[model samples]
Target chain A: MSAIPQFGNWLSRRLQGSAAASNRRGYNAARHTDMAAEVWVIVRIFYAASLMVSFAFITPTLWKIAIAEPMLEPRWPVFWIHWVDVRLGATVLLIANMAAAFFAAPLYRKRWPRVALAITFFLSVALMLSRGYVNNSFHIWLWLTFFFAWLPDSDSRASLMDRRFRYDSVRVFVWATGTVLLFYTLSGIAKFIGAVPMNADKLSSVAPEALAHLVTKQLMISGDESVFGGLLVQLPTLGWPVYMLVIYIEIFALFALFRPALIPVFGWALMAFHIGIWFFMGILFPMQPLQVLLLLVWSPLALRPFSARGAIEQLPLLGSVVFWRRTKPNVSLMKFWWADEWPLFTVIAALTFLDVLPELVKRLLAAM
Target chain B: MNASHSRKNRGAILPLIRATTREKELDMGRKNNRFKAGFAAILVSAYTLVGGYGASFNFPEIFPFFNWALFSFPAKIYNEWVVQVIAIDGDRLSEPADVHLIDRFDHFGAGEGKVLREWGKSVEQGDLEAAQAHRSLFENLYRRSGAEQVRYRLVLRRSNPVQRWEHGTVLSETVEGEFTWVKDSGEQP
Candidate 1:
């Protein structure tokens, strides 16, 4: 009986030691993940800074050209230069930034310089301002790229104007909501004011009449019916309601930012809205892209809970020999798959190939 | 054994510190990411909405100040008027209508007839002789055919109105008594 008691105590001590070791392992793993994430943030910041500097130099000149020249002049040299500079610059920067994020292991070893960081931030803001006054669609993308590039890292402890930037997520949510609301309100006002002189009775007909005439003239010259011609004709009576609905959607989307549950619904609606515009009006607004980014942001948070539950439910399955054998049993897979040590060159090469394929095809076709 | 225990303690402490730092960093990172994501969302949405509006309306410029208020409607009006005038001119040149008759008078008033009458000395030099000879020929032909005043009413449609103007000197010759002239088997007064 004494031997039996001693054996029971020994088993208990062994179990306790194992639990402590497991806890330590888990802590170590969590610490490593945190470090990796910090590195990613720093990489993103540096990339953003670089892009901001580039944009600051380029955006103003582009703006001047876009404003001064007719948009559809069919000037080949102008078109080629603009297309290559804008699209290539943005794409290359995005790839570089993402690569930096994936392979942030080196960044973790060193602290980012405050002066350099501040300069980047200042340049980004300056780039934003250069085109903000114009309210061009391109500016939105530029601003977003800048914003994502400089998004605060885990280690940033500095306060803005001596006020700690707390609840940054909430602030972002509020800002997005407010901005969308403001835009919606402004748009509604512009339409209403513009159509006011026509009187209520003729107001509905005004846009249709104007659009029809414009379309007819364009068709006479080009022999191509505009995408919006049919829709514009059908929408004469529903103009005011349609306008109001657009405003409502914008405002509602802002609200959905706060209540993430409504996101899928709003996101779908927004997608549909963009598709409708594309088909009916032949306008490719950046709303779809924005929605995609929003979905990406919410993905980690919303999917985390469900995934956690799934992991818990499959804990027994994870312990099975089949699963263990299929995975690297002898080697720790986690150690081999450090997030910060991803091959930047591979990613860059892959992206380059993907981006260059269309151009390569075109060139080959031309040569042939 | 003591040194090994101390080393283990250090290892444990390092992990705890790292974990705490990581947690703080993650919290801050998440906050910033969230804020930026939201800001970006709003900006992009606004941009799209504005772009859609500009495209649909065919605003002269995408900017609010340079839109329809500044350019499009005015340009549209100018283009419409120019097109209408061009269409009218094209219609006139393609058909033979009252416009051709007006063109004839326009040619007579503006061409050789005006110069001859204003600068020449006598009726022959002035082209008045040609007009008189034609009038005399027409009068003789009418008299030989026994034609009198040919009465005609100028009718104009209500929907298509025409304006006419007349200014001329009239000559009257009065006879005190009725005189009969007999020529062969015909008598005319």
Candidate 2:
């Protein structure tokens, strides 16, 4: 019996050794996979960082102008030159480029989307540099670009892209949170420290005059006092709450990115606040749209784990392929699989062609 | 029979050991990844929050040279030196008069001429000098009026030439010259 037990132990030891070798092989493979993912994340992050820095500089430029030259009268001729047309064109181009990247990321299985995205990125930088006008509108584009660029797509999960994306996302979240907090804390401190009276009676009486002056100084050519007077009368009753809320929101915004549910609520509140300012005070921060986009795209911590898992699971296929598979789960009926998909591909190709056609025409016209 | 059985048992044990080791390695990797991510998050968050705190209270106008160690010290000095000057000069007669108060005249033009033009219609004709004096007194309220440009035409002949002053000429006319200083009930100057 003793001899038999010894023999059994020996056999078990040999089996264990073989299994250990197999396990080591699997571990090596997983490590390699993770390293590859980290590299891709890094690249994506670098791209995001460049875009963000470009955007930050651009935003401040607009603020500087607004502060330096408070537009008392709407210079319509200069408006198109300074504010509207250039921005519209840049926004359209950026949106189109982003759309293309989204579509092409999964298709073609090439780096063209990266190149295209990079081009759009550069275009945004150029727009900021060339365009002097800064407002909430420009900010919207910047935030939108940042959000979309950070989305967990195929490129982001690629070995070279994962670490970059992770690092960049963390960095961006920190920067945004820091900025909001700074604004909030400083505003709060100012209100508390500055001798500006915060009483309802004082605010009601004083705020309207200030608002009127601001509007007359910044917007209306005639320097209409009535609009501001009306707002002042109404705002004083509401202004204190709004002022308090502004501080509250900024401080709270730091946590909103982590808590996904709060984002939509906060986003709506911010939009309402901005719109109210625009309508009543004629003060608009052009970057509100970008902020809204950020609020919408900010994934909640609860959802992040699932999304991260999904990203891992969806790694084998490109973003478009995953989207297509999800959208058309029952498209296995055709006799010829590739033939059946021809219609979809054709539509996508047409859309793609249409998108690039304008640029092509412009280029051709320039050449001629 | 015994040897064969022993060999079979050994083989089974070997595979199990290998499998267990693999699981342990994966667990370690997952733990390490989590630790790094957590560390990065903490670093980013702390840095951002602290930085933001610094930025928010850095408004120049409200807290000019406000050091945390000597909060409100600058304001006190400013009030004593700057505000006192304006008060003593009776420069607070203007609608909004303060150290940082921005007047329209400063931007467009400011001097005896501009002051006279603004108050000329408002003041009684007999009290024109009084109005001028009031204006001059108000002008002395500010530390210094920002610079202004002056333009004049010198027509020596039919060909007129315009001379422009970019730096601006100073308004040094005395308030005493602009208005009659009435004797007070108690004393006369």
Candidate 3:
């Protein structure tokens, strides 16, 4: 009994000592813990923006008149749900899609926030199925929602600008980057594969005429009778370069996977590409450019300002080099994929630059 | 005596605070990072696998990824499909009269002619099933729009969309397919 009191007194003194120590180191510890959380907040904001752009930008009822028949197969297993009046069903889907999108914004990293994300995914799928025409671009949104919904909620609802990096933050970055890269690779594969119809004479090859024809057909179907597309039809020679350029961009988009710094450049190129498509084809892929913005460019712009000269940037030539080094990258492919071999990878990347000059020369010669 | 009593109170509370903080650290430390990442990974992989399979097979209603294969077409094929509703006054088919509700720019028509346009496309694509599926609905709307006896005639013409867009409608070689549905007489199946 006497020994128990003595032990309690000793424990109390130890606790008091540690508590004082914690107060002294509190700032650094708090900052370190919050780094991941801050990054997550940025990502959450981007997700919300993407949701708004995708679900809210278009008039929900625009497709109602075009839905002639109920879909042959509904995405949900509840077959009887399809029995509702088509217009009423479509309206419900549209309303639900918008509601979920509005609520899922900010991705609070809590249970209810996750539920909202889930609802958004299901409703988006339902809306796509409800229409006579479904855009495949929405698939990436669904996959993103699925990943985000699984993230653990934050302890406190602090501002996302807090510079905390956490386990979940890393996971989201990896998953999102992987998904975007996979999409680019798949697009490239689609072009290279024999799936596209070729001319009868050139059974294996895609003739320029055939590609030109398809562009014209797509534009007409979309109600875009643009003069630019008409000009392409009149000048058959322009078709080859345009088609090849499209293929090259689609393939090269894969490079962004290895070098995250190239994402902003890629995003701008994608926007230009989409804008061109809109002008010529009269079809707008709204979600794609938005996806590029949220996935690639938003992170660095949020984290680092170009004008903020770092310690390295102040040094002459070395400072410029350091400035590039200090620029906050969302993820370095070399560091993430092979941290030990990053130096070797950098060397390899440098070596490839030599080949680039020769390749450009050959291309110019060929064009001539 | 008063100062000693105050110190005792704080001393009692300090151990509890330390114990609680330690408990929180243990809880946070034990979080299964792998499991969290694994769940998302498995879900994305499974979805992509199923989606890719469905897309490759060209299954209708499947989320299409490769629907527009780039650089594969050898020729451009552009076709325009038009649907004209002609009223049948006894045996004489009147000069293709417009169905006001379906074609006219009203709340019912919405000015876009979406139904007629899509219906025409279905016919042009040789998707007879899709074309036939909405016959009753179209006829009902036509009757509601004040057409007592009418038949829908589909006219398909091919032209480059770019040319068509720039230079008004130049419909070529009309191929006609007609579906007759009269309000009192019922639909001609």
Candidate 4:
């Protein structure tokens, strides 16, 4: 019973310490921003490599369909297709898009190259999708590269603003990491929604049979059979636990923003999860796992082993419980985790509490 | 005096003075941190609201901010399409053999399967014009399979993944269509 009070006091101390750390990370703009810039440059180089590799991916198909394949019912107007002989244009733009990614990666520090790369990549992918060869892999890169391109390039000479407050590279990092996290989290939510009976309000338990069914279904559809895929079908319930972990990780991915520690943890978990899918399902979404690896698992922040302990200690409510230490509390006010001191943290707790507590509190008060 | 215990005299007042002094140091960027707090609120809300809207519905083709409905479609039973290439030796049907057409377009396994199914559906309904668009893609696939000239038969297979896995059973299979082509310089044969 006495330990409960100790837990509260420890939590209060941890929040105060974390608030200080977050402030330091924000205030030391040069240090953190430079780190982010370094990561940006590396990702740029990798993006370029990805584009160069696509040369092989694109040439084989050769957009023969552009001239021969019908495009009568494109999702959007085939204006780009109509602009310059669809086959010639797709060939030229795709080659240029890959070339641009290669060049843009190295010269991204220059403004025009970065902007040009974004637009060209967007156009090339959009053009391919418009031809109705839509792919899940394309959409993953489609959203990530385009939106992530907007993150502040600290070294860019061209993007030197006309007005607004200069967003430091670290904030840009949060925005980017947050975006990736949001992608996975919502995907998990989508799975939960899927588990429910169509047009129903309740979520049914995930049965082993269900996962087995999914494995069997993918194997037959793709014809890219794997012994592991066959095993999932044979075991009937081998995949539910693994499937559950994947859903939980994806759903809780955004919590990494508050904790910052789960960055590498989730990154590695997702990468492994993706590899499992590729081997078992024969559906290779190569770009998505690669992006998660680059942005989350191997980011500069994630690699900071010693300093990250402090960040790890800021894992919302669990930090204090996991890493307890005695500290004398001495401020004009007692610090609270869900308060102004830990503003970033407050949002997560506040949103959750607002939904559950405020209504309950209001009723309690009324009863009183 | 336990060695593992995290305690220092527990008197509490001496550390209190030290904490008071530390608070003053922490105040240097107090106002700036308030800005981070505000931005944090904005960031969380923007992603959840916008991305959540995309998730709750099915407008995935909208690009970057699309739904993540990867395997959300529940699967006890599903459909699989197979295209078997039959060799054309002279004027006779050279006895149909099982050809894994999917292996020909192995770069993107799942998507290529969907494309094959769409073309098969067109053939089933006698929509040759609609099917014409996919012919070249299939032609390239056939060429890659080292095919010289062949008749392609589309088969529709339906089964429960778990039942087949558990009991080594399949529900049903039916042939959808049979078609062939020949052309020059990257022509279909």
TM-score of each model, in listed order: 0.32, 0.34, 0.58, 0.66
DockQ of each: 0.01, 0.03, 0.13, 0.14
Q: How do the residues A138-229 of candidate 2 rate in per-residue lDDT, one tens digit apiece? A: 32333334434443344333423355444444444444433442333333333333224333222221232333322322232112233333
lDDT of 3 by residue, A208-327 (tens): 554456566665444446647777778756766766666555544544433333445556666666677766666567776766666665533222232233312322122323333444
List where candidate 1 sits over 4 angstroms from the true fold: A1-135, A154-181, A192-224, A231-244, A251-253, A258-260, A286-368, B1-189
Q: By lDDT, highest first, what's the ranking?
A: 4, 3, 2, 1
Judged by DockQ cut-offs, the docking class of candidate 2 is: incorrect
lDDT: which candidate is best?
4
Tell me the spans in candidate 4 whose CA falls farther than 4 Å from its real position: A1-26, A29-34, A54-78, A131-133, A151-167, A197-205, A301-368, B1-60, B82-108, B116-154, B163-168, B175-189
What lDDT tens digits, residue by residue, belong to model 1 across residues A34-86? 33343344344544443443444344434433332211211221233345554
By TM-score, is 2 or 3 better? 3
Residue pairs with clashing backbones, model 1 = A172-B35
lDDT score for residue A238 of model 2: 47
The ten-residue window of minimal lDDT in model 1 chain A covers A69-78
Tell me the spans in candidate 2 whose CA falls farther than 4 Å from its real position. Answer: A1-123, A126-140, A143-229, A285-294, A297-368, B1-189
- What is the C-alpha lDDT profile of model 1 across B5-119, one tens digit per residue? 9999999899999999989988876565555544553444445444444434331224321121211120122111000101121232342222113322111111122222222
lDDT against the true structure, each candidate: 0.33, 0.35, 0.49, 0.56
Worst 10 residues of 4 chain B by lDDT: B100-109
Residue A46 Cα positional deviation in candidate 2, in Å, after optimal superposition: 19
CA deviation > 4 Å runs, candidate 3 = A1-42, A47-59, A62-73, A83-96, A157-165, A194-196, A199-211, A234-236, A252-255, A299-368, B1-59, B63-74, B78-131, B134-151, B155-176, B180-188
**Model 3 chain A: which ten-residue window has the lowest total lDDT?**
A15-24
